[model samples]
Structures are given as structure tokens and as C-alpha cells.
Target chain A: MKELSVKELFEKKKKDFALSVITQPRTLNNTISEAQLNRPGMALAGYLDRFSYKRVQMLGETEISYLQTFSDDALYERLKEMFEYGIPCIFITKGLSVPHQMEYLANEMNIALISSRLTTEKLALNLSQYLRNYFAPKRSLHGTLVDVFGVGILITGSSGIGKSECALDLVERGHRLIADDLVKITLQNNTLMGTPARDAGWFMEIRGVGIVDIERMFGIQAVRLRKQIEVQVELMPWRDNMDYERIGLKNNWSSIHGVNIPVIYLPVSPGKNVSVIIEVISMNHILKTFGYDAAEAYTRRLKEEIKRQSRRNR
Target chain B: MQQKEITVTNKLGLHARPSALLVKTANNFRSELHIIMDDVEVNGKSIMGVMTLAAARGSRLVLQADGVDEDYLLEEIAKLFESNFSED
Candidate 1:
């Protein structure tokens, strides 16, 4: 199917992204998706970041009566100033009757006015969750994240594949360990991010070693609270039949949730340098993301030399 | 306009990841895609609907996509299932 324009995509998903509240308006234009969801309890304020454009401006309607004491025209002018700043939609609480003019303006602007009868605190929790999924980034890699050699490497493989051991080694070497085993990964915006358990910190449970706490042994500086999982090091069993990439040519992207994070297959061998290989892989991924392809560069250089040799022979 | 039945051979079954992939692929076409499992017809584009069926590995599913691109869409899905569902 053809790709939809940003406006079209927004149109389909905007309604679901909202909390059911009544519409209020300032102008009769009925032209904009900007809205002012007013709630004196200030519940939806938490979700204001992603739905930042969907202006659910929290205000009590009684406050409007206070402004009305000044003059009808003055009250309208004041509300207009608040709206020009920006709003996708607005929900007002207390179920106060909206000004007839504001209602007409909300309908004209398409600023979706929602009046939730719930208390501000209750609506905040509900609306925050309602809007969270839309703002939350999908696609997260499950692995122990470590920043080895200044590279964010997420080590993944079958359970009991020495993933914890490799991370512990990296930590001992003065590298930072983000999470050891059962990393909590989440996406905010488009980036694949990572974090260790708040309670456990970077402690890892190796079958033989028991729960060896890395932060205590390696110091706080040796651990990072969170890191972006830039590179994936997938540990696979050493199988003769399984085809491992001898040459790093085409890249691999492991789909998490919906986002595909770059993945690398690091076959677990008896004495392979897992940490070192993973570090190099991360650096290589960073380089590639910045436009340097190591394999392609090598191929190009080799081709140049071959061409030079042919010219000399001629 | 076309309909065919095939077995889901993926080891993980039609869980979150597979269901999402199927839905995303189906959404890319104009055909109205539906997956029938255990005599239950479910919309392929609805992630929650397709997931509710819980069709695991070796589970037979009837697929039907009715639209202008029905034939082409079904062909791609049939090939995708045949190539990637079973042991490679």
C-alpha cells in the first residue's frame, strides 16, 4: 500500500490517543486539532509530553466565571491567548457548562473537547495510561547491556550461554555494566533503551557463582543505570551445520516488539573472546551507522590495488 | 476472493511477534485479510483479535483475503508461511 502522509496517519490514530472528555472551544473556526482539555485536578498533566500537542489544558470552569466578571469580551480574549500557544485537544473537569461561544469554537477548530466527570486525580491516572502506549517506543532487546570500550553492546543468547560471565568480565575491566541478565528494555521515541532492575541493580546470578553483585564489587562508576542498546550480540551454540558469517557483509536486525535492533551472531565457543568480539561489533555498528562499512571499505581498497597492478603490467 | 488453508509451523506459535508481523504485512495490502483457526474467523489486521485464537505450531489456519489484490496478497502470505513457518 502507498505510504500515508503524516496528516493522514495522525487523523486515523488521534481519536484513540484521547481520553473521553467533552469538547470546548474559543473560536467558531472549527479548523484545528488543537484543544484545551481542562481539568482542575491536573491528572492528564503527566501525559502532556507525547500528547503535548493534544492540549488538554487543565483549568476549572469556575475560573472562567471569575474571568467573566471582568467582561464577556475580556474573558474571550484571555482564553484566546491561552490557546494560541498550542493544544491538540482539551478536557475540562467538574462537568461545568462550557461557554456557548467556546463550544462553537471547539467544534470549528476540531480541538476535541472532553469533559470527564471523574476527579482530577482519577482522570490523570486513566488518561496517562490511555496516552502512554501511543507515546511508548516499541522494540526492545532482552539481554545484559554493557558499555564495553565506550560501545553499548546488548549480549543475548540462549539461557546459560555465559552472557552474565561476559558482562562481569567487562565490568572488571573498568567498562560499565548497564544490566546483567533480565534487562528491562523500553523504547521512548524511536531509540531502543535499556535499564537494570531498580531493586537488583546490576547484580547477576550465575549458576556456579551465585548472585554476585557487580556494583558492589566494581564500584558505582563501573555501572551505568541505563544505556541505549546500540548493538546486539546473539550467542549461538557451536554447531557445525549452522552457517556463521565468516565475513561481516550484510547486517542482521532482530525485531523487538516492532522496532528492529541491529543483531550480531557471536557463536559461543570453548575459548572465544566474547567480550572483545562484542566490543568490536558495537564499534563496527556505530561506524556503520555513521556511514563507514569496514567490509565494503576493505573490498574497495583491494579492488583499487588489483586495478593498479593491471595498469603496471600493461 | 481467494481462500486457502495452511498450518502454522513456526516454533514460537502465533504469539505477539508473529501476530504483529502478520498484521503489519496484511495491512500493507488492500485485501481484506482474515485468518480462520478452529472454525473461528478473525480479522488478520486486528492484533488482539488474531492473538485471541492462539494458533500455535502445526495449527491449521484458513486464510482469505477478498479485494482487488486478494490473489496477489494470498500468494505472498502463502509463500511466506511455506518458506519461514517450517524448519529451514
Candidate 2:
């Protein structure tokens, strides 16, 4: 996620951000709003959504503003013509003055009136990059990731409860590690991806230990740069008083952002080998994806044996 | 027509560097090159197909070559993969 202000977004691009594209506030008679408004891009795209029009306006900000140079009446007529056909947002570079008339009206119409002190080239580069992001496909997720059985296992938990320590144990098991703690996951185009923080890959600072690197002693095979995260496992402190998913018939799931990943729940007990269970959970995920389900297979076999015994009795 | 099954002893399996090297060696053969990882089989030319298998270190992926120079192709492919995907 890149955070960019409207002015920062249109840094140097002039062709698209000129007055001709800006949907000027309709002020046939009087004054309007005070604060500046940043409008969504779709509003601008809607301005040119129709056909039978080809217009290109070059917004050169460094030039002495036309508003300052031309007569008030002449500028008014030019501004009116610019908006006559249908316009989007008007971007002014280097923080030029926006006559109170345009600003007030722009705010009312929900048109973005942006300005930046950046020179033309800088503004152009910035605008191009921002536009790229405007069209890039994306989805975000909430989970913690670690390498298990050569697969990235994203663990989801409610706030805090040893998800990091379990990942640390898995890292020590000679399985390469990916991300720990907060895992910033994203779907680029359609492929799922994840990356551990620069200083955070194998290091676990669990309240008492401060920092522990899963590499130095475990060697290079014990850590990885990035992995296609394919599984999600949730850890909960063991609750003997509560019920756990036993039959595996009701099937459970946990979604990270919009992308739904395979989920498995494991109750954490002091004596339980969580790392081993997590490993089997991942292998089970692989099996399920390849059209084999252990639970499903068991139920089918049980039904067939019941039929076989019934036939013998008949 | 000959088929050979060689285990991917390389640390990174068939990804990036190894895929590039395998593709280079496969391109040299007059026989069409194909790789089978478990039930999935794909052209040796496609790097994505080779990688999607997610065949980790020590996993075995079968290689098959079919042409008049099949024996030469098999031996060369074997020799190329025998060394871990390392330049040395």
C-alpha cells in the first residue's frame, strides 16, 4: 500500500490534469465551499465516459498562470469553455493560486483541485506512477506466515496467543521461514504472495527473549526470501471445556481480506507437539488440493463397508 | 524414445536458476523435453510449469526425451542436473 496525496499523485503530468479535464464548480452566480476536496478517480473517468469527443489540454504549471495574466472577464469565458464539454479534476503544479471562485465551486462539485510545488518533470513522473497504481489489481489479507513443509503457512489468531512462538519452533525444525508476527499479505494480479520484514524474518522477540534469529545457527536452508503462501492455520489455547472441530464434517474457513485460504484450527496444549500438527495440517492441505481428502475418504469407505455387511446379512 | 527419473537434489528444487539451466539444456536436444512431477507432466520449456510443481529440495521429477538422439539427450540432461544448480 502506497499512501499518496492528490497533489503528490499528479506531481508532473500535465496533459491529463489540465483545466480542460477539471470539472469546474458550477457558479453561474455565487460563492460555495471553503475546504479543499479530493474527489475519487471514477468521478473524473465519468466525465469522459461518453463518445464523440477528442480533446487534449496541456497543463504547464511553471508558466505564469492564465488567471493572473489574462483579464478577469476573458479568463472567466476561457474557464467556462474548458468546463462546457465535461471535465474532470484540474491539477495545478507548484502551488499556484486558485481564485476563490474556482476553489469554492470545485469543492461543491466534488472536483479535485490539487497543487504541488514540484517542477514539471517530477510532477509528470509522480502522476504516471500514481496512475499505474490506480489501475493495478489488488487484495489485502490479515494473517501471520511461516514456512512449513516447503509451503508458506499463514497463521491467523485473535490479537495475541503464541502464534509467533509456534512459527519460531517451525523455523527451528529445518523448514525455511517466511514471515512472522504481522504478515502483510497481498494478491498481485491473481497470484498470492508474502514477504518477511527486512529485520523480522527469523527474529522472534517474545517478551523475554528480546530477539532470536532462526538463521545464523540453523543455516541458510532454514530461511527463505519469499514464498507463495498457500495455507492458513489458526492456533487457540487448548479449551477442554469447549468443543473442537472433531468430525471434520462441518468444514471451517478463515478469510484474509478478500482471498479465502484453507484454514485449520489447532488447540495449543502444553504437552502437544504443535509443530508436528502444523506440519501434518500443511500436508493435508496439499492432499486436499490434489483431490484427496482423508476425512471424506474415511466416510466413503465406512458407508461402503456398512453396505457390504448389510448385503452379507441379507 | 527413453525416459529417465532423476531426483532434484538441488536445494531450491526446479526454480529460477535451475529452471533456467534445465531450459537451456532442454533446448539443446532435438528430442522434445518433458518433465513429470508426480501426476503432473509439462513441457520442459515452460519455467512456470516446472516451478508450479513446488518440488522442494530432494524431490524427484522425471525427465523424458524422444528423438533419434534420445540416449545423448538423456545423458546430457542427467549430467546437467547431477551437480546441484550451482555454477561451480
Candidate 3:
């Protein structure tokens, strides 16, 4: 339910999108709540039954051509009826010529009338991309995200559990680091996309080594700007009496902002080669995704062998 | 569930373009579809999975579908294979 004011959107993307405001509404504070951009095809035809007035209206060649077919009187009446809904703004795409009546009515209603040289499809694509990023639900997670064999794994644990050290090891093994300390996660279409926190510099803090710039330290291939997190790895300090799942029959999952991601609890102990274990974990995830569950297959084969042994005994 | 085995007849096999086409086709169906190559089976509707197959020419793969429209989904996937994914 976050609102992005139209004035701010224009200020940020005007030059890049070649947007020029023909007429500004009395109030420059009009805001867009949704990322969806409406073409207003149905509304232009005077059908308001299913109309969503909150969306930003776009007028393209098709809509302009339809308006041209109407007589002056009919056009005026139609435009009047449409503007009566108090829609936010109208963007004329493809540098289309806006009819005089359209501008007059937009100004009369104090609606923002804007024009862009980009084609309708291009404009729509750009606007949708920008708005999706702006309106996406985000969270700042205290973890590290890395890509191993194309699987994005987010490593989380209590402070000073060597999360960054493990990530650094993974980078040395050719895995790509996405975010180091604070991971910025955004849910896009049921997928969690993670990036480094924007405000925090792209640096990882090693207890003794201070902050290390992952990108500069390991070249471009060692870092990714963003990646879709597919799994979570929680590093727990080894305990003497804690029970851990030795058999992989039951896999754990963690839900982040309503999206369930596969999780693995890795117990960190001295001289355990945790980095190699994390690599295997990623490879195992890939195999499981391909429907090849190693543990299940082994269990099934073992049961079949036991059956055969009993038959031989008989 | 319905399934059919088809050979990759496209000259380039299931690379980026063909994988994209296959994924697009799979997405049109409401049924959940999977592509099995050898022992590895991946979601038919995912471009990444389809590309991961790296299936070459003459690579035989199985298309499996489960849901209300499994029959229709199999038919459509089979048609795409017969047409060599329109790559000719």
C-alpha cells in the first residue's frame, strides 16, 4: 500500500524516458498505488463497470485513432465522461498528436497530461519495470547470499558465526557473491530476489580483516548484482547433545514473506571444511530439483536388497 | 498424468531459443509439465530447467504432464516436437 508520487517518478525518469509534461495538474502530488498501467481502452468506450480509476491511464496510437473517429461534439462528451472519473494522468505514447479537446479537458480537470517519444510497448515495458521495482515488498535480512552452480543460497546465523568467512570461501571456489552482510530481499511474483543493501557499501566485514570489497577483491565474476534466492543455510555452532537429521528423508523449509524456501541447518565445527559442505549442499539442491533424491534412492535400493537377501535365505 | 517421449530434431537442439519456445509452450497449459532427460527431470514450464537439459540433436526426452489438462498439454508438446520447435 505504499504510494509513489507522480511528481517524484517524473523527476527521476523524465530525461531517461524522454517524458515532457504538457500540462501539470494544480497539485503535483498525484500518486500511483499500483504498478499496473491501464490503457483505458474500455474506459474510452464509456464502459466504467470494470474500470479501475486508480491506475495510470496511457493513450497510444490505437486510442488516439479511436478518438479521431468521433465527431467534435461526441469527442467532447466522451472525454468529459472519462475525465469525470478523476483518473491520475494520461501519457501519450509514440509522440502521438494529442487532440486539442483532450488537452483542454485534462487542464480543466486539473489532470497531468504528459507525452513521451517512446513507442507504447517500450514505454509500457519501461514503466512496468520501474514500478515493479519501486512497489515490490522488501526486507533487509542479516545474512549473506551467494550463487553456487546457479543456485542462490542465503546463509544466515547469529553474529560472528563466520557467515562472511564461509561466503568468502565460496567465492574462492568460483561461487558468486550477491550480498554480504545485510541482504536486501524483494518478493517478485512469488520469488525472493536478493541484493546488497543499497545504503551499505558493497563490503563484507571480516572480524580481523576489516571490510573487504567483494567485487574488487575477486573480479566481476565473483559478484552478482542480484539473484533469486532458492535456498537458506543456517549455520549453527556445534552442540554436544543436539539432534540433527542424519538421514535426508525429511527436508526443512523456511518461509520469507510468505515464500517457502528450502533450508539446511549446517553445524559449524573446527576443521570441518564447511565451505566444501556448502558446495555439496548446493549441488544436492540442484539434483533434488531435478527429481533425483539421492537419499531416497539409496533407501529404496537398500530395502530392495534386504528383500532379495531374505528370499535367498528361504 | 500423461507422458510422451520425443526426440530433439532441431538442428541446435534445446538451447536458448528452443528452450524459450518450449518453456513458453509449457506455460500456456494449466497442467504442471516436466521434461525428463536421462535420469534428470525438470519443470517443463521453467526456462532455466529447459535450458539446463543442454539436450542435443537426437536426444530423446520425455514430457510429462499432470493436472486437468494433461491430455491437451501432451498433445501440444508433442506437436511442438514434431515441428522441430519451429526451428526447421
Among incorrect, acceptable, medium and high, the docking class of model 1 is: incorrect
Residue A126 lDDT in candidate 1: 57
lDDT of 3 by residue, A163-228 (tens): 999999999999999888889999998999999897554588899979888888888899889999
* Full ranking by lDDT: 3, 1, 2
List TM-scores for all candidates, in order: 0.49, 0.46, 0.72
Evaluate model 2 with DockQ and give the value. 0.01
Question: On residues A1-314, what C-alpha lDDT tens digit does candidate 1 reach at each position?
Answer: 11222233234443543334355333212332322234422222222334344334554555545544545565466556445445555555556666765665566555556555665565556555434433454433356889877677888888888888888777777789988766767765566677775546667787886987777887898998878777778888887545455445667888665668888887888888887777677678778889999877754554454345334434
Who wins the lDDT comparison?
A: 3
| Fnat per predicted structure, each in turn | 0.00, 0.00, 0.00
Give, for candidate 2 chain A, the lowest lDDT window spanning 10 residues.
Answer: A27-36
Cα RMSD for candidates in order = 22.1, 20.4, 17.9
Give one digit per residue, the lDDT tens place, for model 2 in B24-60. 6666667887889778898876655654555555567
lDDT of each: 0.65, 0.60, 0.84
Per-candidate interface C-alpha RMSD? 24.0, 21.7, 19.4
- Calculate DockQ per candidate and list them: 0.01, 0.01, 0.01
